[model samples]
Structure formats: C-alpha cells, structure tokens
Target: MMLPLILLYLIGYETRVTTACSRLEACNSEFRTGLEVAGIQEPESSAPYCAELRAYSQCIKKANKACRGDLSFHTSTAVIDSLMKRFKCAQQNWGPPYKRPSVKPKSNSICSHQSNSEYVHCGIFGDPHLKTFTKSYQTCGAKGAWPLIDNKFLAIQVTNMPVINSSSATATTKVTIIIRRVPGCAEEKTFEATSDAPLRPFFVDSSYSTGPEGSVQMKASINKTEKVEIYLRYIDTTLVVRRVGEYLGFSCRLPWDIAKIREENALELCQTGCPGTELLDIASSRGHRLSWETALNKCKQDMDLETGVRNNLTDQYLDWCVFDVMTTGKNEFVSTAHLAQEDVLYMDPSSLRNRTFPLDLNGIPKPSSAAISNVTLNLQVTAVVDRCGRNVVHAPAYEGAPQVGRVAIKVPPIWENRIPVL
Candidate 1:
C-alpha cells in the first residue's frame, strides 16, 4: 500500500510540473505574438514599441504568478532586466514634435513680393554687401524676373553682441545693433526690437508714410542669453508697406548651456530626494503654497548636484519623474469645480451655441446663462499630479508618432465679485 501511494504521488507531481511548464511556454509565445503585432521585430527605441514590450513583461509576470506553486517553473529575471533597459532606451528617445515659434507683426503694414515670380531677392538699401532672397519665391527669370527691387527697403545688422555674465544657472548678455535704409527710398524708418529686448523706438525719414517718423536709436539691456532679432519696416515707393526680415537675429551658445545645466539638475532631483527636505517640510507645515514650476526647478537642482553634469536629463525621464512625484504626494491639485463649470459653460453645445428651454432636475426652468454663486459647499478637487502622471486625461492623438503624455494644470481661482458667465 505504501509503495502504491508513493507511485501515485510522484505521478501527480510530474503532471503538475508539466502543466506549469506548458503554461510558461505559452506565456512566452503570447509575448512573442505581442511583439510581432507591435512591429517590434528588432529592438528599436520608441515609446509605442516600449509600451508594447511592457505588455509582454506583464504577461511574463502573470505566468510567473500562475506557476508560483510549481517547483520547476520560474520567470527569467535576466529577460525582465533586459526588457527594462530597452524600455528606458525607448523613453529617452521620445518627446513632443519640434515647432518653430510664430512671428508677430510689429506694425500695421503688410508686405508681399511685388511680382508673382517664383523667387524674390531683397537687398539692404545702404550696404552694397547685404542682400538676401526669399526661399519660397518662384524660379528666377521664370515670369516675375529676378532681382526684385523696391524703392524703399530696410536692413538690420548686428554689430556686436557679447555674453557678459555666464553661469551654469543663468547667463546674461548684451546686444548692440544698427538699422539702415536705402538712400531716398522711404520717407521714414521704424526699428522694432526683438521680443526679449527692451522696446526702444527710433524712427527716421518723416516723409515716408509706411515707416515710423524719426531717427535710429540704439537700445541695450542685460537679459537672459537669447537670440538678438531686429526688424525693419518702411513704405515702398508705391506707398505699400513692407517688412524686410523675420527674426534676422544673431545666435549664441550661452543660453543653451544654461538650459543643459537646468535639465541635468531636474533629472538628479527625480533620482534622489530634493536637498533640504527638512526645510521643505517646515515650509509645508507653515502653509506655504508651492508652485509647480518651483517644485520642478528644485528637482532639477537636486539632479545637477548628484550628477555634476549638464543637460543629461531627457524629456522622457523628466516626465516620468514628474509623474512619480505628483502621484506619490499631495504636491499638486486640480480644481474639479472649475473644470466642471467650464465643461457646462463652454463645452456643452446647448449651453454655448444653441439655446433651448430646458427644465432642471428640480422642475425649475434652467437659466440661459447658468450661475453658481453664494453657496458654501465642500467640493473635492483632484490632485494635478495624479491626473497627469496616470494619464487620466488622454493625450491628443498623433497621426504618425506614439501618443505623447501631457499634463494640464488649472490655476486656482481668486475671489472676485460678479464673475462673468462664460
């Protein structure tokens, strides 16, 4: 009887082990299928690919759990570690698409090429050496002809720009410039400073209606290192307004260096605790309102201290750190009331565009314009970190790229009498 019982027990144990092994193999097969569906035939660093790989990792984890009691079944730690490394690689390569800043017209004048030609070449009036052509113009000598001439023209030249103060934290610089026009072209000249510069108005040629009436004046200021762009405006001979350059500016490296330092600092903070944690705690105890930007900066500083490097933090790593901090603590908040109010007032088609007589749940006619006032109520506001970190709000869909993560934060409302109904 004892011999028979041992044989039965051994047989049962073997069957169980075989089943567990089969399940593990099935999990691996499913993971491979997921990779194929995700187009991850070869290891490539991309957010979508990494996300798919993570799904495979999850499958492996589930299989490991399912086979927990089986002595012969186990998840491969080496494979998991490899997948994690690949995920990190993918994240490091992902970010929002780059976009160029739009140019805002400084004057009321509108400028266009004089002819319908494919190419228009423009030259400064005074300087024989200065000439530039538009890239979008038709081919030269096609129909409109080359060397498009304007009676009135404006030119911008950067004489000297130097980085006076340079630091890893910030850089200060000065720009000196000059504007000149063709002799007897326009009756006046107006010089417009770049966005970052101090606005100084210097007008020349009072006779020209298209240009600002006055003379050229040079203005300089200490500023965060940035590109120095100057714009020139004047009226052409036909009394048509024309602008010569869009962001015709000088570039430097100081600003970029400072940005790199800040990024590195932010990454270090995410990896480790922010410096002076006790001080931060005390401040929180005293009801200090910590701004999101400030908190982000603090994290950057901590990162810089740890790595002693600049610009080593990628956008993905920073985003992950932000999400982690936001979800783990009450460091942020979103005003649920404001969002709800906005949805009712702006998003609802009936409320915003088409008005209809609708009855409220209380059997009262709903007002054309909804109002919420003079009522003290306890409302729950969600934490901003939680919303952004966990992706509760889906990111806008992109056509060709992975869905990028985003954080939408609402500003706290201040008390004001008679808030306008949106």
Candidate 2:
C-alpha cells in the first residue's frame, strides 16, 4: 500500500510544481518596473524574459544589493527573474562558482607547435620550431630524439634535411656554442637570466646558451615540463646552437599482458581456496552409479565434440585446439556447450562459410560420428566459463586488423580463463 502511494507521489507531484511568480500581467508590469529599478533603458517588449532578468541581475550586482533568498515580499518578480537568469547563465560558464584560469601563450611570443605545449608557449617541453610547409604549420622532427630546427628562423638556407646529424655539402651556416652543466642543475632549479639584450627567436626546451663572462647564470632553459622563463640577453643576439643534454625514453606494456598476470594470480588463489573442489564437484555429480573414471571420460568426450562444433564457426583449426595449460586435469570432461551461446556474439559468422571439423577415431573410444558428441562437453564448459568471465570485464577489443575480411582476437590472460573458447 505504502509502495503504491510512494510511487504515485514520485511520478505525479514533482511535475506540477509551478513557478513562484506566474501572473503574466504582473510579470510584464514588473519587467517594465525592473528596467527603471535597474536604471537601464527599457528593452523592446519582444525581448526574452531571460534577457530582462540578466540585465536586472547586472544592475543589482553593480549596486551591491543582496541577490536571491534574502528577500521579503518586496522582491519583485522581475528582480527575482533577473537574478535567476544570471544564475542559470553563470552555472553554464562555471562562474560565481569560479573556474580555473586557462593558460595562454604570451601575446608577443609565438610557439610553432602548441600540441605538446601545456599552458604557456614553453610550459611543457615543446619544439617551438613549428614551420609552414605548402602554406600550413605542421610538426617536424627526426625518427629518433632530436630537436627540429625551424627553417623560418634559420640564417642560412638548406635544400633538404638528411639522416646524418652533422652538416654536409648541403649545409647551411654553422652556429656553434660551448656546453656546460650549471652548478645547481636539479629538476626544479630555474635557469638564470641570459643578458640585458632583447630576445628574437625562442629556443627549444632544456637547451640554452651561456651569458657573457660575469653573468649570474645561463640565459634561457626549459624545465622538464617545458615552461619558458624569458629574461634580458646581451651579445647573445647571434643565434647559438647548443645541444640538448639527454633524451627522455618511454615504454608501455600491453593491457592483455597485464590481464594474463592477474588471471594467473586469481587461479592460484582459487586453487588454494578450493583444494581440489573441481574433482569433488565432478565426483559428486556422477556418483557411484557410474564409475568415476567412466564419467570423467564421458565428460571429456562431450567437451571434445562441443569444441569441434564450435570449430565450424571458425576455419582456424588451431583456434579450436584445447591446450593442456587451459585445463587442470588431463582427459577430464571438457564442457564447451556454454560457448555456443557466446559464439552468436563473439564468433564471426563468415568464418563458418567454408570450414569443416575433421573427426578422427583411431585409439579414441568414440566413433567418428560420436567424436563430435565427445567434444561437446569440453566446449560447453569452456563457453560457459568464458561468457561468465567476459561478463566480469569486457576485453580490450580490436576490430578487423589485417583487413576487413579478417579479424584478430586478443583477450587478457585472466580472461583466457586458462580455458580455450573460440
């Protein structure tokens, strides 16, 4: 009874809440009065209510009057609407609530490439030598870690860049300078001002030229994050090319590899927790009514047959092959029946168009026709377990890789369930 009433209240009451001020004539008159109260020229009657309200809020804020919620009956609808409109507008802009200031490049200074740049032109280590080729600016660099010299600021001209890091017959004017470690070269220490002269073209991050003899510190240097500190310079008017000390290296591990480790760990934990619970479950299900060993063989036959049936979904024989690593017991019943349902979603229907699963009956107990039946158990079990794990976390999926006609499947080690289900 209470549930029905609660549902009725929830569905019916909230939709009917009316605005505090809904009288249209009163609203219009208040709108006119609000302009006078705000000391603003009257807007055309066609102006939106929100616009009028916005102007009112601006007027009140400028006049330093209390805004909303502090009102007695004297709070006119026009005034209230004005405050409400401004509040709604400010909400979208993330203001009044305050927003983080956006970092911008200096007006006078220009950075060629802004992709790697964070806030300022030199904020993050960026190659400032972005240049125009065929009338557009694009990132330019070598295959390895090397600074790209901006052709626009070059004093000399070169036809084409080459592999060698040294200058050749196609070389331009050479600008050489000495290199030395500043006394306190910690990651956090800022570089000292270069000279008292004006700067022309900016330099790349982590590289700088030394100031004249008595200067306190080196001129310009970029921290690891690539922030630029501009200062006075001296005879440094000439462009001096200094080597950037070291290159930072980065590497990544595939998520599938990580999943494998996690899965292996989970398996170990499960083994410890259950202590042979798998065999126990099999034994309890197929009791003394049938020899435990015979039941196990029957289970294995079922699994193998199921696996073959699933193999029809894919032409790859290797994909259907059940590996020992995926199973704890040899010759034990394998269930892949559950996998058939998942195949509707996972397996490509196209793979089955021209594929067949060969049945071999040599020393095996089941006949050729019965072999498919034998494979069924393993397939069902594998499919069920695979689907359950798939539900836990969706795999990092990739679509057709080699081409549209082909697909590649990569599941995490944990997702593999150490069980095969293709």
lDDT of all predictions:
0.25, 0.23
Point to the candidate with the largest lDDT.
1
Best by TM-score: 1
Backbone atom clashes (below 3 Å) for every candidate: 16, 43
lDDT of 1 at 135: 10
RMSD of each: 29.8, 27.5
- What lDDT is reached at residue 88 by model 1? 78
Off by over 4 Å in 2: 1-201, 204-225, 228-388, 391-422
Residues 128-245 of candidate 1: C-alpha lDDT, one tens digit per residue: 0111221110001011111122111322222212111121111011122223344432333444333244434333332223323322222232222111122222221111111112
lDDT by residue for model 2 (201-269), tens: 344344333343322123322321111222211111112121111111100111111112222223221
TM-score of 1: 0.18
* Candidate 1 weakest ten by summed lDDT: 135-144
